[model samples]
Target: MQNNITIRGAREHNLKNISLDLPRNKLIVFTGLSGSGKSSLAFDTIFAEGQRRYVESLSAYARQFLGQMDKPDVDEIEGLSPAISIDQKAHSHNPRSTVATITEIYDYLRVLYARIGEPFSPISGKPVRKMTVDQIVDAVLKRTIELHSDPKEIKKRKGANHNEIFVMAPAIVGRKGEYHQLLQDFYHDGFLEARVDGKIVSLRDRIPLKRYQQHTIELLVDRVPLGWPIEQNKGLQQRLTEAVELALERGNDVVRVILDDGSEMLMSTRFTCPEDGFTFPEIEPRLFSFNSPYGACPECNGLGTVDLFSDDPCEACKGARLRTEALHVFINNRNIVDVTAMNIQTSLDFLSDLTLKASDAKIAEPILREILSRLTFLVDVGLHYLTLDRKAGSMSGGEAQRIRLASQIGSRLVGALYVLDEPTIGLHQRDNARLVETLESLRDLGNTIIVVEHDEDTIAAADYLVDIGPGAGKHGGEVIATGPMPKVLENKESSTCAHIRGDKQIPYPKKRREESKTFLE
Candidate 1:
C-alpha cells in the first residue's frame, strides 16, 4: 500500500508546478506567509482531487445532486482517500440551528427523557404515574392489608372486623373556570352524589361553583368494607372492580381510592395525574428535536428565540423552543430546557452523574454512550463553555471550524483525507496547545490531516512540515523547505527557516504606548 499522497505538477491558483509527497496518516502542516499557496496546495489541489474522484465513483443520479467538481490542473496524483474538509465557514444561518441541533445531541436528549422522564404537575407539583386496573386493585388491597396488620389501629378498632373504603373518580381538581357542562354530564351519568370542594352535594341541588376559582370534584362510586370476609364475598369484589373502571372512565384514566383512615392513593391507566390531570404523550427521539414540529415550541417554531425586530426571547415558549409539556418532563429534577442550557463541561458532569436502575441500564447504555462521546469531543476541542442551545451563527470562525472538527472526531472515520484551512484563525496562544493536541489525535486515528496554518506552535508540532514560500503572492508559491522541523529550520534559503533559526525576527515595540484617558481625535 502507498504510504504517501504524491502530488505532481499542480498548478491550482498561484501554485507554481508544485510537486510533493505528504506522508499519509500523519499530522502534516503547510506553513508560510499569507497567500503563499498553502491553501492552494492543501485544499484546492489535493482535497479537490480526492473529493472529485470519490464523487465520480457514485451513481450518475446521485452525481447530479452532488454537482461535479472540475479536475485540478495536476499531472498525476496517487494515494488519495475520501476527503472531508473542515473550514472556518459556519454550518448554518437558520435561527433554529443550535450547537445541540447541529451535533444531534438534542435528538438523543428527547428520547432519553421521553422513555424514562418522570412527569409532574406544573400547578400542583405532584408526580403522575400511569397504572393498569390490576395495579389499582392491588394497591387498594395492599393498603387494606397494612391497616389490618397495624397493632395500634387494630386496638382502636376493637372488635370491628372491617374498614370502609371509598372508591371515587376525580372529575376535576384545582382547575380554574366554570365546568357547568361537566357537572351536567356527571348528573346524566346517574351519579346521585358528589364531593365538591369537600362538601357532599346532592345532584338535585343547584350548587353554583365559583366560575373563576379553582375547585376539586369527585364522583362517588361505592363505599364498602375491606376485610377478609368482605373479600370472600363475590359481590364485593365485583363492585370494587366496577368502581375502579367507572373512576378510570370518568376521571380520564385515573382513579383515587380513599381509606377509612383518610389516606388516599391515586393511580392511572396512562401516564397521567388523577389529582392534577396532567398527561404525558408517548416519547420518541423526534419529540425532543426542535427541527421537528412534534417537539418544537409552537410559538417560536423551535427556533428558541424570535425576531420582532431583532433576536429576542420567544414570547410563547419564553425561549425554550419546546412545548410546555416537554419542559414539564424531568430526569433527575432537571427538564429538557435546563439540561440544554448547561455548558458542555456542566452537561458532562450531569451526564456522568446520571444513574439508571439495572432494568433501564440495557436501554439507556447505548444512547448515553453516543451522547457522552460527542460531548467529550466538544470538550476536547476546548468548547467547554458553549451551552447546547448556543446558536451556530453566533460562533466565531475558529469556533465554527472547531465544532466541525469535533463532529469529525465523533464520527470516528478512518483512512480519510482531512483538509483544514487556518483552524487556529482566532485562537489565543493559551488555547493553541489543545488545538494542536486535537489535530494530533485525529492523525492518530489513521487519518491524513493536512492543515493550512501560520501558527508557529502548530508548525513546530507537525510530524512533517512544508513551508511553501520565500515570499507571498507573485514572489512565492515554491516549496522553499520540506522535511522534518529540524531540516526545515536549518535551510538557509527558506525565509520561515531563517525566522525559526533566529537568524531573522519580527521587531517588537521599544516601549509600550501609554493609554489615554480621553478619546483621540
Candidate 2:
C-alpha cells in the first residue's frame, strides 16, 4: 500500500475546498461529466506536479537539456513513480525520422539483406561472381608477376640472345575446371596475338609433346609478392591503410622482383629450357574485381539507391509564407515565407516604409517587385510548400506531432504508456477511432492509461468509471459517483452517468439530434 495521498484545501479548477485520500497502484479511473475537474485532478494536479518536480531535481547541465514544465497550482502532490507521461501532444520537428528508420528493425533487416541477398553486376547486370578475398589476391599476384617480368632479363642471363622472349598473362583465369577447353576456345578465337621470335602465334594452337621424349625444364617461383592495388579518390581512412600496406611490400632483392609498376629484374640464375619441352601460352589480364570502386554503380554511390530531383516541396508546407513584393523578397533567393516573415507585404508597402527607404532602397526595389509578382500567383496556386531550407526542428505543431508518433511507432518499443487528449481536435470524426486504436495499442503494452476525453466511444469502454461532476464551472469538481456502470446510474447526480444509464428515470444531456430547450435539466 502506498502512503495515502490526502488533498487538503484542494482549489485547482473546480474543486471547491475538497480533500480526498486515494489508493495507490490501483487502476483508479477518474471519470467525470465534461469540464468537471477530472482533467484538473489527473493532468494539472498529478502529472503536472510530477513533471515539475522532476525538472527541478536535475543538475544544471541536465536541466539545460530537459525542457521545463510549469508547476501545477495545487498545494501538494506526493508518492509519484519515476513517471512517464505520454500525451496527444505532438513531437517537435525532426525530418529524418521515418517509420522504418525510427524503429531499429530497419537496421537489422538491412544487414540480413546484405548478407544473403543475390547480387548482380551494377554495370553489366550479370550475376556477380563470388571469390574469397585471398583467392582474388592470389590471382592478381600471378598476373602482376607475369606482366612485370621481361623475357629479355632471362635471355640476358642465359646468354641465349638469339631473339626476344615475350612473357604473357591472361585477362581471366580459365573458368575453374575448364582450363583445357579455355585454351582450346582461345585458339579457336585467335585471342593469343602477341609474338616471340617476331612471329605472331595463338597460344591455344596446341602441339602435344610425348613425356618420354621430353627434356626436363624446371620453372620455379624465384620470389612471391603481394598484389598491389591501384586506386584514386578513395576516402582518407582507406587510403591511409592502403599506404601502410604498400610500404610493407617495397624493396629490392636478389631474386626476381616484380614491381607493381610492371618492371621485372631477374637475379643471377639461369634456366636452360629444352627447345621442345614447354609451350608459351598468352592470356590478357582480367579486371573482374568486385571490391574495386570502378565496378560500383556511379549513381547510387554504391548504396544501390538513386536520387531524382523532387518537383514539389515536402508535404509539411503548401507553400506560401507571404504575399507578393514582401520585404523578404529576393527575386532569385526569395521564397514567400521569407517575404511574409521579413515584413514585406507589397512592393508598394516595401517602398512606403520610410524606415527602409534610406538604405539600399533603390537597389532593393526592383528585386522586391519581381519576387512579389511571382509569389502572388504561387500563393493563389497553393504552392506554399516548405522552402528548400527549413530547419528540421522548427516545423508547425501538427507536423511535429505526427513526426513524434512516427518516431515512437518506429522505435518498436512495445507496451508503452500512451495518454492522449483530444487527438482529433484538428481532425474530422473519421480520424478519431484510428487515434483511439493507436492509443489502445500503447495501453496494451501494459501501461496504465488515463485519458481525459470527450469522445463518447472511448469513454464508454473504460474498465472503471468515476464521474466527477454535477456540472461544469465552479459548480463542478466533487466525485459525484464512483463505481462500475450499474452503481453510477442508481445515483441521481452524474450527468455522464445519467446519459449512459439511459434514465427515462431521468433526463439526458443535449444530444445533437434533439430539439433545443432552455435549461439543461
Candidate 3:
C-alpha cells in the first residue's frame, strides 16, 4: 500500500500549482498565515478528491441521491483514501438535534431505556407493568379460589355453589354517543350481550342511551363458572386464555373481569394503572425519542418551547421535550430527560456509577458501554462542559467541530483520511493537551489526520508539518517548508517559523488604560 498521499499540479482557489506528498497514518498540521491556501490544499484538493472518489464508487442508483461532486482542478493525484472533513460548521440547526443525538449516544440510550425502564403511573405514582395472558389467567384463577372459599360472598348468589364471572372488553369509556351503530355492529358480529353503563343488556334490544350523556360500554366476551377445580383443568385454562385474548383485542389492550358479587378488576396487556385506568402503549426505542411523534410533548410539539426565541419553557413537559408518559419512565430512578439534563461530565459520572437490577444490567450492558464510550470521547475533545441535550446549533464553531470529531472517534473507522479545521479554537489552554491527545489517538488508530490549525501547541504536536506561505493570497499558496517540526523551524523562508521560534513577538501594550469611573446608570 502507498504510505504517502502524492499530489502534483494541484491548483485550487489561490493555490499556485502546489504539489506535495503528505504521509499517511500520521498527525499532520497545515499551518501558515490565514488565507495562505492551507484549506485549499487540505480540503479543496485532497479531501474533495477523496470524497468524489468514494461517491463514484457507489452504485449509479445510489449516486443520484448523493449528487456528483465537481472534480477539483488538479492533475496526477494518487494514494488518496476515503475522507471525512470535520469543518467549523454546525452539522444541524434543527432545535431537536443535540450533542447526544449527533454522537448516537441518545440512540443507544433510547434502546437502553426502552428495554429496562420502569414506568410509573402519573396518577397513582405506582410502578405500572403490562400483564401477559398467562399472568392474567393465573391471577383470575387465584381470585376464583379465594371467592369460592368465602361463604359470605357466595351467599348472595341464588342457588349457586360456584363463583361466576364475566370476561368483558371495554369498547368505549366516558364517551357521549348514542352508540346505536356500534351496538348493531357488535350484534351482527355475534356478540349477544354488552354491559352498558354498569348494567348487562342484550345487544339485540334497542338500548336507549342519551346521546348527550356520557356512557361506558363493555362487550361481553365470555361467562365462566369457577365450580370445578380450575387450576387442574386444562380445558378451562384454554377457554380462559381465548376469552382474555379476545377481550384484550377488543378493548385495545385492556380487559375487565366482573364478578357476580358486584366487584370488578381491570387487566391489561399493556403497562396500566389499575386504580387510575391509565394504559401505556408498548415500550420501544422510538418512545424515548423526542423527534418521534409518539413521544413528543403535545403542547410544544417536542420543541421544548411554547413560543419562539423566548426562555419560556413548555408548561406541559417543562423543557424536557417529551410526552408525560415518556418522562414517567425511569431507569435507576432517573428518566431519560433527567439524564440528558446533566452535562457531559456529570452524565458520565452518573453512568459510571449507575447501578441496575441484575436482569436489567444484563440487558443494558452493550448499550451502556456504547453511551459511555461516546461520552468519554466528548470529554476527550474538551467538551465536558456541554450538556447532552444542548442544541447543536447553539454550540460555537469550534465546539461543533470538536463534537463531530468526537463522534468520528467513536465510530472507530480506520484507513480513512480525516481533515479537521482548527480543533483548538475556543478551547481553553488547560484543555489543549486533552484535545491534542484526542487527535493523536485518532492518528494512532491507523487513520491520517490533516489539521489546518494556527495554534502553536497543536502545530508542535504534529508528527509532520507543512507550512504554506511567504505571504497570504497571491504571494502565498506555495509551501515554504514541509517536514517534521525541527526541519520546518530551521527553514528561513517560512514566515510561521519566525513566530514559533520566538524570533518575533507581539509586544505588550506600551501603557495600560486607566480604569474609568463613569457609570451608565
Query: Which candidate wins on TM-score?
Result: 3
> In candidate 3, which residue ranges exceed 4 Å CA deviation?
132-241, 246-270, 307-311, 514-521
Candidate 3 per-residue C-alpha lDDT over 1-521 given as tens digits, one digit per residue, 9 for 90 to 100: 99999999989998889889989999999999999999999999999999999999999999999998999999978999999999996478877899999888889989988999999998899999777888888777776777767556554544232356789999987668999999999999999999899888999899999999889999998987655765587877888889999999998888988765646778788787655656665577878888877788978888899865766899988998889889889888999988998999999999988788889888988889889988988887678999999998888899889888878988899999999999999888988898999999888989999999999899999999999997898988898899999999999888889999988788999999999999897
Off by over 4 Å in 2: 1-35, 55-60, 101-120, 126-130, 138-418, 422-446, 473-478, 504-521
TM-score for candidate 3, please give it.
0.77
Each prediction's TM-score versus the true structure? 0.72, 0.43, 0.77
Report the number of backbone clashes for model 3: 0
Please, what are the lDDT tens digits per residue for candidate 2 over residues 1-521? 25434455556777766556543333335666667887787766766766677778889889888877776666666555434454445443343332222222223222322222233333343333333322323333454445436634432332221222222222221222323454455456544432222233446455332333412111112122232332221342243333223322221111222334434332211111122111111101111111122222333322222332323433322322111111112322332233233321342243234244334445445544444433332222222343322333554444334334434443435433333444344444655555556545545554445566655555655544567777877779887876555675678877775566665345466766877687766
The CA-based lDDT of model 2 is what? 0.41
lDDT per model vs. reference: 0.80, 0.41, 0.87
Residue 178 CA error for candidate 3 (Å)? 32
- State the lDDT at 217 in candidate 3: 96
lDDT of 1 at 451: 91
Clash-forming residue pairs, model 3: none
Model 2's TM-score against the true structure:
0.43
Candidate 1, 1-521: lDDT as tens digits:
79999989988888899898989999999888888888888888899999999999999999999997999989999999999998885367777777887787877787788787777877678887776786677667766677767547544322222367778888877566667777777789787777788776777667787888888898877676664654456666777778899888887776777776666666678766555545554455556767766678888787767753467888888888887777788888999889889999999899888877776667778878888988987776678999998988889888888877877887788999999988887776877888898888888989999999878899899999999987789878899888889888888888777887789999999999998889968
Model 1 accuracy (lDDT, Cα):
0.80
